[model samples]
Target: MLDDTLRPAPPRRGGWAAPAALVSVTLAAIAGFLFLMMVTGGLLRWSPLPPGSPADTSGRVSLPAEVGAPGIWTPDAMAHPIPAAAVLISGNTWYADDSEFYGGLVGAGADDYRVLDNEGAAGMASVLSPDGRRLASGDGILDIAAGRRTPYPRAWTDREIAAQAWSPDGTRLVVTSRPVDDEPYAAPESLALLDTGIGAITELEGSSPGLDGWTAAFSPDGARLAYPAGGRIRILTLASGAMLDIPTPGGAMPAGKGAWTRDGQGLLTVAGEHCDTCGDYPVSWTVTTLSASTGAIAGPQYRLDGVYAVRVLGWWPSGRPVAVAYAPAPGTPATLFDDPGTQAGLSGLTTVGTVRVLELTPGSDHAELAAAATESIDVADDVLAAGTLRDGRRPLTSVDRLATGVAWFVGLTAAAALLTGAYAVAQRASRRRSPGMSTGIADSV
Candidate 1:
């Protein structure tokens, strides 16, 4: 009998290398395919939506980078007291875009609430005067402090104020209303407060204006009134009808759905300055006292949330209400953020300052992106980098660099696969050339 080794080893010559090559080819193909997918992957590519379809991992969903730590309310050099972005704040007043809900806006000055939908537009507004004089709305913009209704460029008249509540002293009432306007919803005719007290409501020729404003309030002394315009926060004095332009503490810009503070010295309005809106986030908070007379900002307060929703009691016997505050981060020293519109529009930033945090894009890893967020969803590197918001930093993923990395990996993998095939073929040829080779070549030459 022939020795086991010499028994013309049938075509049992196939080894693990053959299967191994197949795996390498599969792997090389997979690597190349994955790289392509990484570049052109995700729902955003084909959905026609904007590039960064915000998933909002940083506690803000209204607009990108809008919300901050909601529980922080104490005022200080570093307090994240404002609730950034828009919220449905339910209280004595309940508001709905449909007007079906029963409520008002004067309670919290939430009248500035804007839906984070296809547009920054608001549906209506519930306006109040400073001295508890007027409450109303219309296809026009209501100058809150002035207690005057100015016809809006757009005409939205169906919006209505669902409820109305007065401040402790009855000087102001929180009216539930939407503040922006659009197509059939022009004029922000959402909700409003028609001050039975204001002298100007008589100017609208009576009738309270625009679904007649809703839920109004008064300051502790009943001297000041608060309410919302489009994105404007208005504070008026009953005796003078003097309108005070209040600046939202952080990045929050009033849209409506707000009210007067306990002191009735300030007005509270839902505010937003999402990284999407601001396009960048400041590293610190800006505290400025604005002129109730001219919409001009003044004095510096402190740096809290880079962006947040703020409440202001217009005029206080003890001056502005000083909220006790603190920062969420331990090592990040607080610095005043900037508000450029502080003077020009009573809409700019103030108390400007800077922050330095890592950057991230909207489409980053599902788990890692949120972990990378510094404060809220509105917190962008550009928004939080420089104090003055001068195109601070870039958030894009650097597609070119990513592409280079993938190319390198694919090339290396292909080379390794080719080398394996060459080696395998050589080994088989060597065995066939040896006088001891018994396996016949499947494809003969």
Candidate 2:
């Protein structure tokens, strides 16, 4: 009874549908783009969000500004091609500190770094055993090829072992300890030698006072332990149980870890510039050798002219002392170092300019610039602060990550709904034009 022209209009979708759908798709694309931008904020260098985003979408975790000088073989270099915070060189292979908190062995020609894990292997403050087949840490000793860990002696359970060094024969460990049963563990009160074979412990006590609990370097023959006590180098002869204090002129304090020379005749140590008239902070530092026999200063005291702080890494195979030097961060007040509360330590200081390497020959009064690091070293700050381990980055809080997911979901859902609506409308129009399709709903007759 109704003419085709007058027939009831085919069901029309909402007038706002098309425009709203288009707007949603556009918004979704923008959101997806922003997410991508956030993901690669550092690589390509633009961020969609203003300076302060709820998430820490920022720079990439990159290698140190520069690699160590060629042939220098630094841990940062051995971690090469990746970055490592700690490295130990044993002969030809390099052991780097990886996630296990122990050393991960990697060879120059090897494909990957090796890690070890087992019951007692999980620990911190790692050092490689002399045999190169074992790795020792605060918790236990890991047998590299065996994938096994031997826990420390039960007697050390209640004590916090602060420092450890292996005997040259790989049969013993010299450790310093302090009790940690609830009370704060103070400077090491006891130094002991433990025979790894039988687990027997021997106390090294001759002067009543304990050696530096934080660090001790063994002589090449393992006959003595060289430590710092009250700004002087102390050599403890294990065979005779004698303690000798090496006097340093001008009240110079030991600045970093010391190592024994290849010949073991003198000890390598970095000394702080003595300032009797000044306050707590030393103005500069110098690398010098001390006579192993008498603890007397020997050789030239090579003072790094512009270096503000120094870390004596170890001795290179060629007997050159390997060290990392740091300069003050730009704009840091010159007076900052003078303030004890200003928050600069071995690990916390932010450095400006390229970190330079210094290799001083044992007897030289001057140092050779081994190599220059490519970029400034920022020791403490981290960039990938907002991803998950499941993702590539450290995670933001659960709520923030959830919100990011939801935003993505909503954008996509809106786009899907828009397309679905358009499809339904198109199907209706197609049926009307074909003339054979029927609206399934028939008249109530």
Candidate 3:
């Protein structure tokens, strides 16, 4: 027999050994990376969804410059001891998109923020109860303190439901429902009041053909509801089942949603001015106070300038007007408000810029910033009305950024390796099937 050491290694029966080894190594590397991330994340106390903690009572927190560097942020103090909460969306690399983001109560310097468990809860239109104990969404009610979710009753399960506004007493919710298969932009098929206590449903009349803006507001005392319908503000008295329609001025339309003044004497609606020459962008916006009794103009009509857009959230307990101020982000298009109709519609633009919760001071153009985020930030109407917002700060950590980069690298490497392995398998099989053919060149060791 020829020297055993020189015998050409049995011509390597299977070409899968190299690929198999590569796959095994890739798996081991992935597991090791995961373990390292876990350890580092724990040591850093950083997570996309952090657990709840007691309210921060150490006073207003002044955030560092990094807090404004495109990530989820929270305030360190509240102007007053009220249950104010907000939904914070991350602007970081990993959670930049609509599907991947963080959402929950912002805690408003009270308790540590809590993340919602429901899918797409981050983007859903949600409102806090008057007492701030519960949050209502299309899925159902979430008890904040108890951490429990109660789905809607069977009677309303067939239709797609969205929480519009909660009664001042928190006993009832104004909800809009549409057929499950209906187009998202299509008007709601019906509007109704759902009793939170007994799970009862009372459908409202004249809500068909639906409301134009898909948003409604309860008066301060919760006696009436105001919504935009058929190009006019429609006020419905809950007890009498009577309806009142207030027409908007020419060339002006309801902007997103409206809020009832603290005194309940007027309804606050954003009047978006249309300009044919201005292209798709709005010429200007004005927070018009319409009379509750008549369609006539009521109180101060503040012309909101120096901002891209504004949404009338509600009034603070101090009677100061509060709203969301949207400032154009770097690459924001001029057609930002081309479809200024509903809260859900406008929410799609949060990624277009920075959102600031502002308390518009009466008799002054200066607006005090309550809270802000680099991306989207939505506070509950009740929270804005009942609680006080103060300036506070928190810094963003590097752990999340590092983790995101590492995750991307690992994913790409594994994918490339797997593809290479598959190609090798295919080549080996082709060679085995064509065993009768021979190449002029011999295989090298």
Number of the predicted model whose lDDT against the real structure is largest: 3
Which ranges of candidate 3 are over 4 A from the true structure?
Answer: 1-102, 108-111, 118-124, 184-186, 205-214, 251-258, 274-283, 306-308, 328-344, 349-351, 361-364, 381-387, 395-445
Using lDDT as the yardstick, the better of models 1 and 3 is 3
Query: What TM-score does model 1 achieve against the real structure?
Result: 0.32
Taken over the whole model, the C-alpha lDDT of each candidate is 0.31, 0.46, 0.56
Candidate 3 per-residue lDDT over residues 1-445, each given as its tens digit = 2222332323546666576658757775875676575455542332353323455645332111112322233322221222434433333232323222334455544434444433222222456665556777766887765666789889877877766678888898877777778765535577778889999898874454333333677887888987667667788898898999987665343333337887878877665554445433444567777787887888777665545566666666667677766665555444333344442334444434555666666433746555444444445554454464444444343345545556676676677667777777787797677644333443555
Candidate RMSDs in order? 16.3, 14.3, 11.6
TM-score of each: 0.32, 0.51, 0.64
**Candidate with more favorable, higher TM-score: 1 or 2:** 2
Per-residue lDDT of model 2, residues 1-445, tens digit only: 3323324545645565566667767777766665665454321221112212121214233212223211212122112222222222111111111122223332211212333221111111244554345656565665644546687799988875533466667787766666666233223467677788998888763222222312466776778877656556678888898988887545343333336665778876664543433333335566667787776776555665445456554454445655656554555433222234331332222333335545565343545433332221111101111111111121132223434674677677666767867875886686577644334443443
* Residues 1-445, model 1: lDDT tens digits: 3233334644656677788789889989888786767555431121111312222224312112121111111111111112221211111101111211211111111212211111111112222232222232222333323334444222223333323333434333334434333223312233333343442221111122212121133445557554444334456566776766455444333322223333333343222232433213333223343443444443333233443322221222223232211112333222221233221111111221111221211121111111111211112111111212111111222223344566788888888798889988988998777765454434333
| Pairs in steric clash, model 3 | 55-110, 61-393, 63-393
Q: C-alpha displacement of 298 in model 1, angstroms?
A: 12
Ranking by TM-score: 3, 2, 1
Model 2, residue 435: distance off in Å is 30
